[model samples]
Target chain A: SCYLIPNKMVPGDSNKECTDLKGNKHPLNSRWQTENCDECDCLEKEISCCSLVAIPVGYDKDNCQKIFKQEDCKYIVVEKKDPNKTCDVSQWI
Target chain B: SCYLIPNKMVPGDSNKECTDLKGNKHPLNSRWQTENCDECDCLEKEISCCSLVAIPVGYDKDNCQKIFKQEDCKYIVVEKKDPNKTCDVSQWI
Candidate 1:
């Protein structure tokens, strides 16, 4: 599974380039880009990224929490169903 | 005014508490919560937070970038208007 690795956990040189899940190389200190299910950015050696999922409304909060929770990552309510206002996690690029 | 202060920049005690925009105090390490237009979390002395705003789907990316850009912050497409597929920043807690 593709996920973000924090700069502190990154070993070796701080300026080392980063490889996305697709094996695409991103230079150091570059803005985040989506790779597979993750959207990530690199700053120095630290990288911050969030997983992308298209969840429907009425999804269990606990389940969503469990599915999306990871070290240094968070699962937020990024979208909601219209009119009904159910939780949604669509839109990733 | 209420924004995250990174742990490294925090002076003196490392376990100092955080104050939200509404003057509510959070412990040293706590999950993020919304205060006004910001959603913030504290880890040690470093705080990570994002400003919140409702934007339409057709909202110009450049304009949105200019409006929400801040030091240590990046504006993302967190939500979109359903049906019409407009940008929305609703649902803050």
Candidate 2:
């Protein structure tokens, strides 16, 4: 299940802790979130995540290379300099 | 301002609605969620999302093609047949 911890509760050490809908305290720096098929680490106030799914079947090697050239390939390209960068939740604050 | 709606509360229509910490109701099928740099649609019980960030600045055309190779390239590959697919929350249920 996903947990929605407030940005404020994430960086401070206090009795006021964030919790999931179940009311369980969501600890800081916990690897508790998932996105798509990838697991994520819940850091100070962000979720650092990445996927490890292999290239699509049949579209391997040269085939994958060829497909990557098509205009539609733009949709699949990873534009982030670091695709695994932490997703700052502080922005929501 | 992320909402922690229970998976059960997501699929049905009732007086029991989900809300963020602010106590505002999180409507179903709303484009209210986001991941990484992408906005997402909050569907019946899932988050349908995708990224629109342009394929990195410098690494365009042939340069991007070259980087698509190499073992480390696997780290940035988008392997989901459809990366824009909805993330089913039922699994969390």
Candidate 3:
């Protein structure tokens, strides 16, 4: 879901554009994906973001690791010692 | 991805089971889905939870609303004024 990151109150700016945490400005009503894979909206007073990827968790952390698939915007659980081997992921969030 | 919610440091307890925030005890290595749709794992020191559903965001919030489908563990963007009409979802997290 979307979570709003409130903008630092600027004394007189009531514009619809938004400024992200990185200090990058985006035009009003614009939508973009961050470098960290969060889809964000440029609102009037806040920057709203939602994760674009679902992370796989609840796996055997001792033997498995989660890897991000940048192309698909999701994660895969695999054997830590062998990337080619898949691991059982109990859940994703 | 998994987010750890550390349990209160209870003195003298080193058990393998975990006590959730709701005070529910779960055995170590056991995984369960919470009523809120989060998939959690019972670890020794903390409860690790992952969201099982990808929430739709970046939609026209002023005109559309999100509806959760429990059976499918996903969300649908629909017209706020008319649930029967589908809305365009800009992204899902």
Candidate 4:
């Protein structure tokens, strides 16, 4: 469920930290969510990130559409034609 | 992010499997989600379960209410009076 990225640093730098895709520096043991909504942890040797959003996989894909809401790290499944209406879908891991 | 439950078994049983809260048995290395949307893995000594649904923490609680949809394992933040309206809120880890 999570991906690991080896920690890389400047050649002359001595500090140990994780750098995110946006070039944000985080101290070891720190946790954060990326702009892409990936929940990441700054570990000793690498950065581990897992998706905070779960894409709708069991929905009626033909008649429904999945929209990602970045502000909340969630997905909304609604009718394709009438987005105001939510579509019922089975839940899965 | 996950909680571990020690694997318990019958006094005379020898198989190594995890028994979930619902009394379902899962073999080692197997993974599943509970009825409550907890993603779980059956490990060697315990069952690790993490909530698949992330509760809205940075939302406007005064003007919005979070409605949990059991069918989809997600929360919908809507207006206090008009449930059809979605409220804008800041994102947080």
Residue A24 displacement (Å), model 2: 15
**Which stretches of candidate 3 lie above 4 Å from their native place?**
B1-93
lDDT of each: 0.43, 0.32, 0.70, 0.68
Worst 10 residues of 4 chain A by lDDT: A1-10
The parts of candidate 2 lying over 4 Å away from their true place are A1-33, A37-49, A54-93, B1-25, B44-47, B55-93
Question: For residues A19-69, what per-residue lDDT tens digits would candidate 2 score against the true structure?
Answer: 432234555566543323444454554334444322222222221121111
lDDT per residue for candidate 4 within B1-93, as digits (tens), equals 344455765677664788765567898899997644678888875676777877565787788766555468776677867868987757632
| Predicted complex 4: CAPRI docking category | incorrect
Select the stronger candidate by lDDT from 2 and 3: 3
Candidate of highest lDDT:
3
lDDT of 2 by residue, B9-63 (tens): 4334553333432334556666643323344444454333444332222222222
lDDT of 1 by residue, A32-73 (tens): 644123467775644556545432334444423212222234
In candidate 1 chain B, what residue range of length 10 has the lowest lDDT sum?
B63-72
- Indicate which candidate wins on TM-score: 3
Please give the distance, in angstroms, between residue A34's alpha carbon in candidate 2 and its true position after superposition.
3.6
Could you tell which candidate, 1 or 2, scores higher by lDDT?
A: 1
RMSD from true fold, candidate 4: 15.3
Best by DockQ: 2
* Model 4 alpha-carbon drift over 4 Å, by segment: A9-15, B1-93
lDDT of 3 at B43: 75
